[model samples]
Target: MNQINNLVRHTRLLEIVGDLIRVRALGVAFGDLAMIENIDGDQSLAKVVNLDRDIVSLQVFAGGKGLSTDAKVIFLGRALDVVYSDNILGRIFRGSGEAIDGGPELPTDPRIPVGGPTVNPVMRVMPSRMIETKVPMIDLFNCLVESQKIPIFSVAGEPFNQLLARIGFQANADVVVFGGMGLIFDDYHFFRTAFENHGVFHRTVMFVNQASDPLVERMLVPDMALAVAEKMAVEGKKRVLVLLTDMTAYADAMKELGVAQELIPAVRGYMGDLYTQLASRYEKACDFKGAGSVTILSVTTMPGDDVTHPVPDNTGYITEGQFYLHNGFIDPFGSLSRLKQHVVGKATREDHSQIMNAMIRFYSGAVEAQKKQAMAFELSPFDEKLLKFGRLFKERFMDIDVSLPVIEALDLCWLTLSECFDPKELLMKQNLIDKYFPKSAHSEAEEGETVAQVA
Candidate 1:
């Protein structure tokens, strides 16, 4: 009971105007944590809405459900803080930063405010270093550069969750923080075991808001996860990766709140401030002035695979790049990381850019070849070569199971190119071909008369 009292305190009431409860107080800060208490025979959850001139407003989290005008509101007198320490690694927490796995409560520390301002532009270092996940499709082509904000735009039932898990397992980061909003029970369990099984849980912290949890709580997970991530990066933890899944849920929660508040609706029944809300989170990925960086890789699932969905449409404007996950794979043609150019050849090998471009160009041709074949069009000899290259590309490079470092993936690209066509047909610089082309291609060329014959 003492703990409960410490968490909730009384202050002089400034005014109670309609649903708004205003109070004069001290030690109340913006985003400072507060909890609802049953007073005047009321039972409901409440959220902190406004803190001004040491006065705080407690907006009922449960929509003032079962709460009378005289209900007691308690201020914790401290900002919302997440438990941050080495002990947080390998732990699963609810949206409120409470342990849901029946583990001991995290030790208290100085409260850290959530949803802090974005890093200043002058302080942000230009992103150059690559954060390798060793996923062939991602590392080889759509590289995850440091401090880049990219989204995995996928549809439901696709392997976006698995892909995120794989990246979390393979990322060479000092720490990984995962925030799941409105995830189902299966996805929550899958992330838990995937980290545990892969031995990466030792450096991972997860804040999950499941679909069964209170809807209001779903909106808090990102702020919680990003706050911890910012702290870790500021402490010089290099390569801090923040993974958020299903931000669409978070947006929907915002829309629900807007409707409850009777605000005017924006496009698609979303709030007018949807873009600002998303940018606040996405812009949190920054390379600090003197500290380590925070890289954000989030999943934004499209409704009915519609790219024009409000969530993804607004996301596309704010994020640096996107990985399009389709039909259980990262679509090579559709997925893109705009920051890849910053690191592809400069941070990686000289052939990194060349190979990525050539492979995708060839794959695009293969797509056209596939269309031609489907239509029963007469295939040119070159078109036939494209068909063969496409099939091999899908089998060797596009498949999610094929994992390799960026360099090794580039090597496989050369091998694939060599196996399908002659050096001249590849349209690559003669110098690069002489340097990186597989020896098998030269030997096969000695036996074969032409590129067409090889295909």
Candidate 2:
């Protein structure tokens, strides 16, 4: 493409493989948008995916089923972009950035190119603030720090979508951008209804690519959502939380495209660039020094519960940490937040760190005691206490439905411990114990007095 003749058109395609079409053209850069016009003059969008010295391979947004060798390919001389504005809020879009919610169109909204470079380190603020989700397991243990990029690692048959929706509505963010890839109709409907029913739709923007949609569009959903989120954070100075579901589907789309383009495969037939592709999006989560932040929380489901699967395996290396959802609970042992230290004690109450450590310690003990009991070993007095504390731990905090503020959850943690063990046996910090231990745990006199006061 040149300034003198930027509109370049080719009337012949060298090859058409699946959704990919190859054309010989000059001055076309990678990722530049194009239009493929059929003999009937019907046009579909294409993107310059691979450019090997003028043999440009474009992935047709609509599949190549009805296209012919004589179809005209016009280079658009620009990258793929999406519409952005205040009007985009409360609206839903397909992966191609077209409105699918049957709402009014905003043709006048400014468009921003998607899949851009990550924020420069010099422009980023060190993450220090916490985004409270009100879920006891998350708030009390693995705290979600602003600008953090993390994923929920689960498998099929898990309620990861439910957990994601709960966090979307409950999280402390000024704006929400949700992107769903290869979702079935029910999953898409559930998320939409969840946001509407919880009264967050007014501040939310959704980009969905259903299972029946084009595979190329699935790859576009995250980029579009992240672009809108970046706009909201940098321009509007709004704290944005981006929720992406089933990134495995996104990776699968990439794999399918790579296969169509005849690219060499890496692990499990996934393209070798899987890690790079994922990092480019995850690294978009950032906090601007003088502005707001973009925090990403995504779902990556493993096939057959295999952690070594290419998708989750590569994700573990790029993301800060992961929340492992299993058996309908965020597993205390598997879930971790690497950035939680930035806010666990500083942003939260002083006793938060102590409470979190002590609770996990006792829970680990409980697991051991349960195993010993299962083996028919004689239970020690302390084992009995561990068993009881473990039961209360799961009931009070482990359930996905358990919602409580951070402070209240900490208080409940203390109460649960007091009911199971003597105050001296807690082995927590002396200062925290003195300040937070239930008065009834120290003496029956205080308990009776408390009951009398309540009466």
Give all TM-scores, in the order shown: 0.89, 0.95
lDDT string for model 2 (1-455, tens) is 26414565798899999899999999998888888889987889988889888799999988899999999998877889999999999999998889999999898889999988999999998999999999999999999999999999999999999999999999989999999999999999999999999999999999999998888899999999999999899999999999999899999999999888889999999999999999999999999988999999999999999999999999999999999999999999999999999999899999998889999999999999999999999999999999999999999999999889888999999999889887678888888887889876768645666799999
TM-score of model 2 vs. true structure? 0.95
lDDT of 1 by residue, 9-29 (tens): 564445554334566667776
- Residue pairs of candidate 2 with colliding backbone atoms: 1-27
Q: By TM-score, how accurate is candidate 1?
A: 0.89
lDDT of 1: 0.82
Residue 33 CA displacement from its true place in model 2, Å: 1.1
Which runs in model 2 stand beyond 4 Å of their true positions?
1-8, 445-455
lDDT of each: 0.82, 0.93
